[model samples]
Target: MSVTLARELACARSRLFGLRGVTIEQGRILLGALEACPRWRERPGIGELRIFRSAAGHEVLLVPSTGRVQIRVAYVVPPIERFDAAAGVLVELARLGRAARRAG
Candidate 1:
């Protein structure tokens, strides 16, 4: 097989095997989007906050960063436009990461 084909196969296998980790990463990103953005901290205008399962069978929390400057929860898939949100969620994740590291 060509190197490209082999790489593709490996990529597919990695995707299948690493789904759980991917979901956790997504969750952390979502969480970070809310935490990093100070605007979403105090009032959190339009965004909502809630935990829900993704279609991929992974658990994640949705925090919308729209409308006002709040981390609103929508309890659904795709997490609205969260993947593109600012670093609020990630900022929070950093703090959590530090806490976890300390605990560990």
Candidate 2:
């Protein structure tokens, strides 16, 4: 993780602390999911906003967009299984990224 992102995530964790409907543990899991997936886009003019979309269509929508962090979860998938699958996808993507860099 980039220094800026790490800082942003820390701030996000602080912001999420004690908020209703999202437990501290859940917040950690959600942030972990965000870190696992590759970044989708950086919304210009937003400070340290991290948006990630997995290939399987799970999303970690973090900071400022909705004025809150949220996971737009695919309801058909259970939480544990969904994150497990996401980890697999991320590993493949990382391998591909490394291969492409070497090839180039």
Candidate 3:
């Protein structure tokens, strides 16, 4: 699907989750990554969802069944540096990816 279509779907899905009392910003982030990269691996038994790395080198684990998203940043250097730098990169990439799709 086109990026614009994908974004629309993501937003709609997020709203659905919100109605069900689940927040979905993180889920949208992971969905954006999957849309931009399309390199996620499915883990059926674990959570019936997919796993992928964000552009920031953080592991984004998405549980579609539960509408739960987890961002994991390694503490190799320092806690602050790792999360801040990696999360920054991930957020920037997500934004650029979405914009690129819309522009396309």
> Best-fitting candidate, measured by TM-score?
3
lDDT of 2 by residue, 1-104 (tens): 10111112222221111112433444444445445435442233247556566555544454532334444434456644644544443444335434444544
For every model shown, what is its TM-score relative to the native structure?
0.24, 0.34, 0.46
Candidate with best lDDT? 3
- Provide the lowest-lDDT 10-residue window in model 3: 1-10
| lDDT by residue for model 3 (1-104), tens | 11111111222121111112223553554466565664443333353656665433455556765655454553343543543544453455456446655754
Give per-residue CA lDDT, model 1, range 1-104, as digits (tens). Answer: 00010111222122111111223444454455435434333332233654432233332234333211122222232443433221333344445545544544
Model 3 ranges with Cα > 4 A deviation:
1-45, 54-57, 96-104
What lDDT would each prediction earn against the true structure? 0.32, 0.41, 0.44
Among residues 3 or more apart in sequence or in different chains, the pairs in candidate 3 whose N, CA or C atoms overlap within 3 Å are none
The pairs that clash in candidate 2 are: none
CA error at residue 42 for candidate 2, angstroms: 8.1
